[model samples]
Target: MTTTRPGGRSARVRSAVLRAAGDMLAEQGFGHLDLAEIGRRAVVGKTTVYRRWGTVAALVADLLDEMAEESLPRTDTGTLLGDLTANARLVADTLTDPRQGPLFAALIASATCDERTAQALHQFYETRVAEWAPCVEQAIARGEVPAGTDPGEVIRAVSAPLYYRLLTTATPPDHTVADRAATAAAVAAERGVYVPAE
Candidate 1:
């Protein structure tokens, strides 16, 4: 790696702290990540970490944003079911991955207690859902499903059960479960499960 100095040592300290914090979050879970330890691991002052990132939640929120940005692109397979299934599998794979699954579970648990974490998580899901909403909207326009389908609801249904499986159980939710959830939600939409507003 080329050591391109951006603004001298202060910038380097920030970069080191953020990188160390991210590593701790991904590997040790958010609850186990100590701010002072992060600073120590980064070879920076604790005050510098606190002054820049404030709380653990704030640092983790930024970390989660980085994770979201690095996530895979939404699949557009024409049909709503196919698109949802694709998205479901993506979420399932992420949730079941050895490194990512534990990190996700920890972040989710923290969100229940932290408003900032909750907001960050909500925004992350919103971005992901919006990416795939077009697939469902197109299906509705094509009359493949009911005239009024709430795309957001459909998007949520695909991953909701998968996340539940990820956080609550020992067994990981696989592709088959994802397909089932997507199919059930899509079929429900076909039968006017979510009747759109007039």
Candidate 2:
């Protein structure tokens, strides 16, 4: 049972391949992705790429998993509004980033047509939402939000409008928009809007 170390050759190959894939996705969209081209760009063997990831969807799923694993942790600001503001700002920053913004757009476009990619995208958001949900839970404990407030719902609310703006128009969500989103979500949560009714 030989095991691959974290910083070994295998890890390097994975990183290079994923980077190439991301660049291609951002530059050319998902329809133009090819394992052979990815291998050439990554300087890894074509056989290695095919054997390791099997299909484009699988490779994309792996990339999404890696992204989820590497995403920044949630901010802890002691106040629900502050924490949510940080979360919204983080989402805005990523959506407005040159490389990340286009990459996410391509990924989302692919997910719309590919079931595997859709599942992967869902998992990615679940991980992100879970990471930030504790802030809402803390708010509940502090009596800032009503009891039984759904932490995941509140976190999702903070990001939904930002994503909507990013996907619907040419305008990127800025810090002011992020701040407003956080404020709205916090206000709604405080009023028990996120709490599930019986």
Candidate 3:
């Protein structure tokens, strides 16, 4: 994600701007964010910010992509249940963290009206989900799941409730929530809820 800054203001400047945008998204939210203010907080020039992103939605989109890249890599915990449990907790912890959750919510709200922002947000989750799909596929290969299990579906299933919690309620998604998600996914897999192509 090479942000196109016209008169390249050094990598340090770019990083600072991105970090500042993240902080602003969490604090003031994208709806009311001011790029000039972001430039001041980042200690960069307004020209640099304007040349790079040109809009608040673009700034939020870039920040979200940067966050996804910085997040930890997916883990393989042996079984689908264990792996999904790990996945759920990772997502829960991320969304429930002091700074990150609000930042994400702010960006998510922005995405509702901005197509590019929405696509970027979806892509971030898709990449994460795809990273863990192999765990479910391995289970299928081992007959741990029924034949024709859709690995992608299983991966998405584990996150569905966790996302619901984030979208609907104040209850933090934790180990208990993660376990329930993993259980539901496991049961679905067992019941052939994710049948792959015949």
The number of the candidate with the highest TM-score is 2
C-alpha lDDT values of all predictions: 0.81, 0.93, 0.82
lDDT of 3 by residue, 1-198 (tens): 435543455667778998998888889877778999999999898998898789877777777677767778878778878888888888889889999888888878888988878988987887787788888888888788987787888888988888788879988688888889988999889889799656
Which regions in candidate 3 have their CA more than 4 angstroms from the true location?
1-9, 196-198
Q: After superposition, how far is residue 79 of candidate 3 from its true place, in Å?
A: 0.9
TM-score of each: 0.85, 0.97, 0.91
- Per-residue lDDT tens digits for candidate 1, residues 22-101, read 67776876678788999999998899888877788877777667676678898878788888899989998998887788
Across 11-46, the per-residue lDDT of candidate 2 in tens digits comes to 999999999999999999999999999999999999
Q: What TM-score does structure 3 among the candidates reach?
A: 0.91
Clash number for model 1? 0
Rank candidates by lDDT, best first: 2, 3, 1
What's the alpha carbon RMSD for model 2? 2.4
